[model samples]
Target chain A: MSASPNQATDSDRSEVTAGIAAVLHPAARGAAREVPDAPPRGRTAWSLLGLSGIGFGLLAVSIVVSVRIGTSGVSYGDLGRSLGSRLGVAEPLPRLLDSLIWDLRVPRVLMAAVVGALLAVCGAVLQAVTRNALADPYLLGVSHGASTGAVLVVVLAIGAGSLGVTGGAFVGALVSFGLLMLLLRRSGLDSVRVVLTGVVVGQLFAAVTSLVLMASGDADATRAITYWLLGSMASARWGVVIVCAIVAALGLAVVWWYSAALDAFSFGADTAASLGINVRRTRIMLLVVTALLTSVAVASVGAIGFVGLIVPHGVRFLVGPLHRALLPFAALAGAVFLVWTDALARVSFAPQEVPVGVFTALIGVPLFLFVLRRRGEL
Target chain B: MRITVEDLSWAVSGTGILCDIDANVTSGETVGLIGPNGSGKSSLLRCIAGLRAPTSGAIRYETSDIHGWSARQIAQYVAFVEQALDSDSDLRVADVVALGRTPFRDRWRGLSHTDRAIIDAALAQVGLADLRSRGWKTLSGGERQRAHIARALAQQPWGIVLDEPTNHLDVRHQLELMRLLTDTDQTVLIALHDLSLAARFCDRLLLLHRGTLVATGPPEDVLTPDRLRDVFEVDAEIGQDSLGHLTVAYRGTA
Candidate 1:
């Protein structure tokens, strides 16, 4: 008899493989099962790294191509010159084109990529902690809370500029998250309670937003607030982009560090505890981190939908469920996905730029349905 | 490791689930816990495994009091297999077994070669190495139980605690699992509903009736006809079979 699987011979391996086949497909005796293949040990890591390299390559192409798609007639040549002159390698372009390429287009595209990555990562963390497949960044009501705060600032003329609105939105998000935490203080942060409480909070904030809109009776302010709530990258600037990038990078790193712990949570709280996880503390910490990331994103832009809900599920289908491989791939795929979608939003109507959020849903619904059909859920 | 429970009592709201119970499991002893339904067997096991804090009692694993120890520290000494634990994820058999290495892992490192070796050994012990890549959803009830046992084995703990582990297993699987439990070197405390299986396999038996430890000793002494009638509400005869195995023949309800 073979002692260990590592020491087994070719014949022994075949026998084991045959046994697996028989178990997986009872009706069709020797046929292979169509289940998602678990990446085999040694070379799997290298292959994942290679795939990440390709993803990065695609993201770079997306950024360059998106930067060129506007009514301003700026081409890839103009983009390269602007970037090269900034790095002291090539001659500077005309002043108007330089600012257009260097300041406006660059910041907007980068913001889209960063927000997409951040939302997707937050969604993955929430889904793992709550063990719910439909979880996303907005599941905590942070986006609705942000919308209410922004509306109040816009209609009443609160502090000062866009900075004031951003600040108000961030504060509003934190307050809603604080209420959620207070409600979950005594409970174990179980799946059903977290989800139901989130829905209730979201509804409360949404109602407040509508009430403020109706009371103002000013059509222009209402229109502006509604456009912002639907989500746009037209307001993207260097300061906002830098802040989102810093927060997103840091948040992704933190979530990646807890990848193994997330995998242990598949069986529920008690099983995770028996495997040495501090279930309550881990759940609280992850919820807080995800909420903070989401608050920053919704404050900078509006409540962008679908990136968070769609990307993690799609990536899991390709990489299997271990978060070690899932998180990074989801981040890269999300960055590429948003850059192209934002480009489409800019050119879809030529003179009028649609909200990128609208396009995200316009594209996300069909893609999500495709993923479900592939998984045989439909 | 020896497990000691000193005057353990647990209560929920205002009602008591377990009350002033004391027991000990010496090193390498296989102790069977037997009682009727709702006899506090599951509560007692949870308290011992550090999953629940008792209302009044102290549990000691070896010499250290487990009052302030974190869940990780407790897991390094004792592995617990819960009854009817299932998942709806895409975790494979190997992935499930790798969970047992959670206590020994650092924050930044993947599983080392030593960890993989131990996982392989655990799977081989439970005869599931051939199905390492098989999905959890595709497995039968018996295979799932065996995989969970393999997970406990991969923990390399000094003791293992189980609650109704054989509940949905077929008869052959039940016998195999008992044989494996008896063969292992780790100390075991198991809750059981099958009296004959318990009598034939366990080194000693502990009987609980309505949150009290009514009897504890060798199987024959603790499982007397009068105790069975009173505690379990069953009329039975206790004797040996022709094959020289201790058996319990139940007549009917008392």
Candidate 2:
């Protein structure tokens, strides 16, 4: 490298000048016109759709198989007949068997799928929105907030049953989200602040939950709350399943619509804004949506763990990081994953019936490490 | 597009970064913004690019006030490249370039045929057509700068603003990037720390001292030795190189 411009000869400078001129000449300007019709990059739209079709097929199969795997000895034929009869296409089963399948098993399987999908998509969105790989629904404090609300309701004997707990959880989740926004009001919602503030709020709520539970002095209620905290699909009913399904679908749609904006955020907020994203508005909307979805899920299932955190990382590894493909694929992969995990929890210990959250971590940790290793980030 | 900055001023926390600045770059002209550190060069460029709102006055692109436009609408006409921008995500070069078309497409649509063609053209223009599939992490500093420039080209913007784009480049790459910018027909407003490069490559120079525009004219007039001492706090000689280009030779700090 030449440190002194004074050493340059006129010929050397002229050569550089001529080189630039040749590169910028009108004939060379056609360099762009001569672009060799290169093949498209990454997966084509049809291939992506085909892959999504496979994922959906796998989820459907998982749900049906999951509904059949229990101590009741329900056969595949019985499962089909039950579904067909509900759809009015086949003969109805006996009263007890129909109630068992329709009112319990089917809704429980569907609820697990819905909850899993919701958590996974929320995780992926939060990870991108916050630029933090470790972000998940639990990290947002919404789950702990819900637990605190449900704990308070239970200890006080509000007496509206599960509905009262659900209502309390939703309100608690909202309060935590409100606090997060208030704390971030002057901070511009940057990634570090968002993640640290979320952790702080979650810790606060967790402490409150523990304090209320210890102060109540009711062993039975504490045991019940403890089981709920570990999360289960045992209480899954058609009403809650339907409500969760609707919210998850709408929320996923909202997040997916901002897929391009998420891509822009890869270079940080200033670049994202320069690329035409309304940075503040987009971040707020995404945060609110993710928090709401997590609230609805936590209220019903009592904070199922690992699915949101691990599923998105796994999906990103599989399909790359473009959120349009990443979000849907994550939803499908998560739904299938949870349906099977819930089934394993139900039958693994048989009469003991271990919590699904326990199985998720047991399975999720190794899978996450595998993904990290494959991505060369381990 | 011609950019007009009329009585523009900006402040942060009640301290003004740019004060009562006024300048204009006619369509297809290359203007260099030269100033020492903290002299409001980047601030003025950001205001013209519509990234920051001015505390007073206005920036107009041709006939329209850009402050009244959406970010998308502003992006369609003027592309901005900051001094340092990088990403940690697993985005390919082509994926980053495709981001340039964001303002044209809506949420319901994917890249159109025309969008692909334009992306190809942009890559070719920046000599990165073959490196389109390369991961961002794999690129060297100069290649990354070219890729960023390619992204700006993909926007098909009529005017481009860059702030100290050659900061980390080697001498050869710095010269090449300057040549590339000068060759482009788009109106260019760039901030440069290298007085010699700015003098040779840019059509006109806008010189700043503190928050005010101290000089604006051809390089020979703006790079006078006395102004260099007063504004840059350096004793320097303005001379012509063997190639008959204006050259600023710094003697020492004042």
Candidate 3:
């Protein structure tokens, strides 16, 4: 039963798996997991749902705690005024409530949540797009680059004021992103290469920052740079909080819209292309959005570490690689995580606040270790 | 749909892969291409599917050159299942099959009911209707392969391309998968290492050696002892099965 070339099929494909049965060798000598029907599907779904629910629950708790934080203080009328208004309690049981709700507590909570969600969402998308578990926004040197720019404005008086620091940080982020593209084009944007390059660049900028600090004669400027390096939400006025939230929301929307493309990417570049995805274009878009999210978040929070690297990995164990599911869960989890971390930072030493980034790093490293051990990847 | 490959040559990383080759395949027909390792079998297949561009040839589908065609455009006529056994995440069997319809989907639209129905039919065709809801990563190797084949089938392409789809399947599934294609409307292009299997089922054969076309004819003409020794460097016994189909048995080295 043969036909001429003219009668052959249009596909003209080769390597047909015509006749080979891989016997399920119950004892294939060294088989890790049997290939058929090994892992439970329902359990994964159930766990993802449960974890998301808990995430929301955590967000609620965080919001409540953030509102209550300034209630105990005597100097702050903000919390008490807001609490009195909320409870319909008699008159002014201390006006700490109004100040807390309007100026410090509420705005700080929102900024932390916005930064955390931005980081976590970007992290989740990055990991999926690059097909690596360790991908994060800061893997491109944006964080350190921003830091160098902000440090210059603070310690070297290059900007000579607060406004210049933010603008310089934004410009620094753009320049580093461009440098990353130029230096790493040949290898095809590998996740490991990008992250390692970022680390190297980060050290270079760290040296620059050190040089500036050592040369500075102003103690107050040096202290400001030091505090900023540590990262905090203490400076989140309502205006800054609004900007952070807007950026995070817009960035998250872009990521959410491209979730389908992200899902396709996990299968490999060739497969995704065969499915009609413009892989290169989509990747470029993802990189841009994540960078925007990173710059805005870093600018607001002054380089809070660990949230971006750690939250998405924790969420992935529960959710798998579907970006639509992974992203929302990661966002909620991140907000909750940063909220609690920020709260702990504020309350740990009481009047003397710890830098939230320090607390996040200290707690994040162990959790990260535990997750790695659980995954057997260590 | 009909495809014509005219004087095709392919180069990769400055190395020649496929040199001066030509072939044709029609819609709703079953054909086979047989070759040894590194004979550019996969590369040729990729070029046909528009997944890769040939250095000096045009693969035309339905009279349209696939040279500059997007993967999505070519996908409408051809669905390719690669040789690798792979599954990511805990996606269900049905979900994997439905992914084949991605190219057919409007940019922002969700899966249509027709898409789901086609996926269901594909699952049924592969004898996995009962397992449609099963998670992909949990399936047996054979089952996973079937699931991918089903996915290609769901795309409703004019022909389906299989790249060593039977590498991991045992004899039973091997027969089942081959048999599954017998009555289908979609044409089949399969690359096989086993000459006997190719002889028993393939309607036509296109044989390659050293990235060049060595022979093209009936299994009887193509699977001869002389050609086997010349191209594959193996001595083999060729005969007829009780079903009057060509059958081959490898004897030894050339």
Candidate 4:
């Protein structure tokens, strides 16, 4: 297999057209910071981040060590020395292992982790912002919004050089966010109203996405659409890694800025307003940030769902709602989750790929529900 | 620190709620607002806190019209602890109290040392220091009410508007909370359903009936048998308690 992580192999890279310029993001806005007095809420946030980072670090090292062991039998002595040769470290061996790690798998898995982090962090924010446990990229219509934009690009046959599917998706998600905010703001910043409105918008866009997919030409188009919905990191490259990183960092920064407001929001709007938050502005900015985060993740992997919704809730169980703690922990949990999940995807059935989205939803949903059940809810 | 309300009126939609009501609170005094349901106790508090926009009236805080101040600006001067809704589950005890610093904390930075100390003090004041790490939703009804008060205390305001702060508090916690307000230098306007607590704690009482100011004076003068019968639809005997404090006993019929 010619699949690589740093940049897509020629066959995989063929899926995405080139020359899309990356977007520059604004400095941090609307982060949920720890209250001046809130002792950092959770040991879990720190433990989650620490444990997951270690897990990924160990796994990455293992993958590198495994490459040197060989396909035949795991050679104990040659493992370190053989790996050293492949990485061009220690001494050059007969074959290169560094190439296998850096180019073939490392970047791809890392991107998967980052993408997962973005989705999960956004999910946490979206759930809090909307005050809906069920809220996520999938439920909020953000993914649908992005997919709508990407599908429009596809139907128009506009390739990467022209605004690109990513750009389209970002705009679509943002537009949906604006619409939801307007609707919810007018209806009284009630939590149930926001969730219900998101549902309506999600349904509307899903209908549009289906119509577009149904009308598209050939089995190839349908297959592409299905794969996109299921999500994958087949198109990871140095350029994508850079762009997505910048965007995700920007979104997280914005979320950090709004941490105080989010703290207020966890109580109802009246309580938040009494806390001296500029509720309208805070709400608008948070919606915008979560939407952008969701869009960027959607653009890269194509509509992965439960990671965003489930990851944050999981983090909250360990940490708490102080978004300052929640957002960062959620981001880390998400990153670690996707990395391992993608690894499972790679190993579960070799050669023919299963979309990472399927596994995430499958794993995240039951797990999140279990957490909720423990907390005494649906 | 002094608050003056003159000719205040408010209406929701086309229906009138509070009509031409006037009240006042001097600095360092606790003013109890007593009224039956639909008598505009909450509406009046909302107007005082600038949560509601009153028509054709002036609420002045130290000679500046409070009506012109934004909610955030008002929050700097006044902390309003409304009745606790179902306790906010996502917040821990300390976090709930620290939110009072929402007016003071920088948007993105961690809380200042002073902010942390004050939050600690507020939690301790409410006897909830031990519950600091406990979730807000798990607290008992009385505890949640106290937590909300602690949140208001975090604001460090000059005036506090409390809408039935004793609503969910048990009799003991209610007395404790009410007594907690006695030492405050800030002017406090509290809405109370229990006239006994009001008579015990308040220096002055503002009685409203159907959005009209029925009486504004000390509890001794305001809690008259006639006023109780007319305003609350109950017959009551009003006299001095064993401690020589004015008290009231409700009878069977209006």
Compute DockQ for each candidate against the true complex.
Answer: 0.20, 0.23, 0.14, 0.21
CAPRI tier of model 3: incorrect
TM-score of chain B of 3: 0.96
Clashing pairs in 2: none
> What tens digits encode model 3's per-residue C-alpha lDDT throughout A210-307?
78777876788788777877789887878877887888888888888787677666557766767767767777788888987888877777888888
Off by over 4 Å in 3: A1-61, A70-97, A160-162, A190-230, A314-320, A361-378, B106-109, B242-245
- CA shift at B102, candidate 3, in angstroms? 1.8
lDDT of each: 0.85, 0.86, 0.74, 0.73
| Error of model 2, residue B118, in angstroms | 0.4
Ranked by TM-score, the better of candidates 2 and 3 is 2
Residue-level lDDT tens digits of model 1 in B107-140: 6888866566667667777778889999888898
TM-score for the first chain in candidate 1 comes to: 0.88
For candidate 4, give the DockQ: 0.21
Interface RMSD, all candidates in order, equals: 12.2, 13.2, 11.0, 19.7
Clashes of each: 0, 0, 34, 16
Which scores better on lDDT, 1 or 3? 1
Best by DockQ: 2
Q: For candidate 4, what is the interface RMSD?
A: 19.7
RMSD of each: 7.7, 7.8, 7.9, 13.0
Worst 10 residues of 3 chain A by lDDT: A17-26
What would the TM-scores of all predictions be?
0.90, 0.92, 0.82, 0.81
**lDDT tens readout by residue for model 2, A144-170:** 899999998999988598888888888
Model 4, A202-307: lDDT tens digits are: 7787788778878876566567767877888766665777788899888888888888888787767767777777676777677767777777778777887678
| Model number with the top lDDT | 2
